[model samples]
Target: MTAVSTEIPQRRELVTELPGPRSRELAERRSAAVAAGVGSVMPVYVARAGGGIVEDVDGNRLIDLGSGIAVTSVGSAAPRVVEGVRQQVGESTHTCFMVTPYEGYVDVCEKLAEVTPGDHAKKSALFNSGAEAVENAVKIARYATGRQAVVAVDHAYHGRTNLTMALTAKAMPYKKGFGPFASDVYRVPTSYPFRDPEGMTGEQAAQRAILAADKAIGADQIAAVIIEPIQGEGGFIVPAPGFLSALAAWCKDNGIVFIADEVQSGFCRTGAWFASDHEDVVPDLVTTAKGIAGGLPLAAVTGRAELMDAVHGGGLGGTYGGNPVACAAALGAIETMEAEDLAGRAREIETIIGDRLRELQATNPAIGDVRGRGAMMAVEVVKPGTKEPDAELTAAAAKRCHEQGVIALTCGTYGNVLRLLPPLVISDDLLREGLDVLADALSPKG
Candidate 1:
């Protein structure tokens, strides 16, 4: 198989309209065949993607700012990932790790142990998606601690499964109709500096959450405290300094397993191997996905060997978990990250995007806040002179970006935050152009 090229021209060029003719046709077909439950942010139908551009069927090349929701951090069609998957496909697709294991799977686990935030001997179990990895983390925590209750924070989004829905705080689309969620899940306050009481330090916020958890579900009864180091779907909310470390210390004192949901923030997406590394906070368990396997589906839960090995031999794993192809892709992706120094690249991205957004915030009252680390930056939109969310304005800005051939995504519990997750491989020129589009989109119109 020929290697997928990473040499696509690093520029955005729109021909015809936004959706164009071919994409519109595909949209019609999708409306009929695809389930209505699945949603899409842009109308364009992609034909090929590389570096920073996603080419559509109608021959329009759009600048990719969303990175497929932070999944393609190593860049779409990364050379190493393409080569690895090509070779793996020729050899074998699946023997089912549960049935007949492969070296690729073992190699991925070893890599996970090395990169995850901790020096302790660690082991890992692979899964198919972020939600699956999170679910398995909770299982391991509960089993090891002999406890039942799990604690989640406000605005947190774990996943879509019944159990994860219970963990997620959003109710509209993710949890509204889906009732009767998994039991033993509790919610607490999180340190959102933008909305917190004026001058509330991270330690104070941690204490408030601790008090709430203690009052609601005694710490001794809690199995695990799972959180996204820098929440992904929850508007890229980065907690105040010292918040995570305080929580980790509290969990240690309480015998509760601390799981960092780095599904979105891992694999150098946040200027570091893991966001937890920024604060020197080591979680008992770390769940990873998104950028783990390039564009392929692969997730993992890596943690202390003792905690991971607590379960029975066959207790962990799924039929397609750690499929050889995905494992190969992960190895290749990790290799690319290390060889390319994507972590440093992410920090550079943070400098570029963060400076631009902060400048925008200075003049635009609608931009309530500019926050997040590395390439996972966001702008929270709000009514001028007030903290109240402005979902309408957020939607309008995102729509404008789409019409201008830029892919942007919106998130947050209130749906009023515009998030940017560009691939680490994106060119400086493309990044600036995409930012220019966003700036124009957010600008007030007559």
Candidate 2:
């Protein structure tokens, strides 16, 4: 129901080769000014973006499939967000919530309480990024529960900061030589239906995860059990049904906080207000960012009022945790979501994407899996007729996409999953064209 703004032409128009002269110049400048570790999938610098297309410095208008890693679900430069930010910036950019405080922060927290899963009383703490929100959620859990051990799932990605790095599962890139990470963080297996032994049921997968955690680290000692309802960086791995409910029940029984890291799957991107809504799983705490504030940086951790209140006064918050501009943008973003019924739009997009990808799977043996919900969908690339990951092919296919003016992103621990996260306001024609271009990139001739 969210309307695509008419200001942006909802079509793909390529006027130059990918990474033309202007982009090449910017890349050269970036190499000298930016850190080598700061990597980007597509180095073509964005000059403008709206609807489903991003115009690069080289004037290459490519179909946007990655919504700035899912931050612009309301669309980049969403009218409400732009105007809200403009007004807030004029009034005051930062009063530092800890110092003078502000109404914007309170308003955002109220919206979060109203929208996040469950009908119980809730409280929230704001932060500048998803990582900060996660870090603080962990802090709140440990402080409230008086437990030190944290349990995260296999293939989980929390964040890059030292504490979150410990919670994270990947070694290369995110972990590498960064450790020795913080202590008492445990990793347990989760239901990844695509890779699990054949015919495993949701109940069975949940029990396996439960047993893994109980045996490795006594659940009584755990402060929190955090997971992504639909794992994002881990290839959009949707856990089997009942998996989340089982975890929630176990946490409640053990006095352990259940946290859902909804950084990528939240804010109506997953055909629901939150992915947890799909499973009727009410998390004790939910960490959100990404699409929460259109393109402005804002994140929050909303949890049960009792647990949040358990923390000492001034236990949470940072200088720019809830910058007025970001808060204003979040307000406008939430208003847009509710007014437009974006959850419905996400479901509509899911049908189109799922059907098209399934059709591709019918012919392309390299497509091992097509999974995910709503706008948060992805396809796994495997060796022809085999489940073994074909990361090389995935990389090559993505390169092919880039050369042809399509912004396709490749993710997954195995580096073989092609993720699609188009803006919610993207036109149906634009989505079809993006899919067609993707089909061409994956075609045998390509």
Please report how far candidate 1 places residue 49 from its true position, in Å: 0.2
The local lDDT score (0 to 100) that residue 274 gets in candidate 1 is 93
lDDT against the true structure, per candidate, is 0.94, 0.91
Model 1, range 242-261, lDDT digits (tens) per residue? 99999999999999999999
Top model number, lDDT: 1
In the range 17-60, model 2's lDDT, one tens digit per residue, is: 77788999999999899999988998789889988889888777
TM-score of each predicted structure versus truth: 0.98, 0.98
Candidate 2 residue 321 Cα shift, in angstroms, is 0.2
Model 1 misplacement above 4 A:
1-5
lDDT score of model 1?
Answer: 0.94
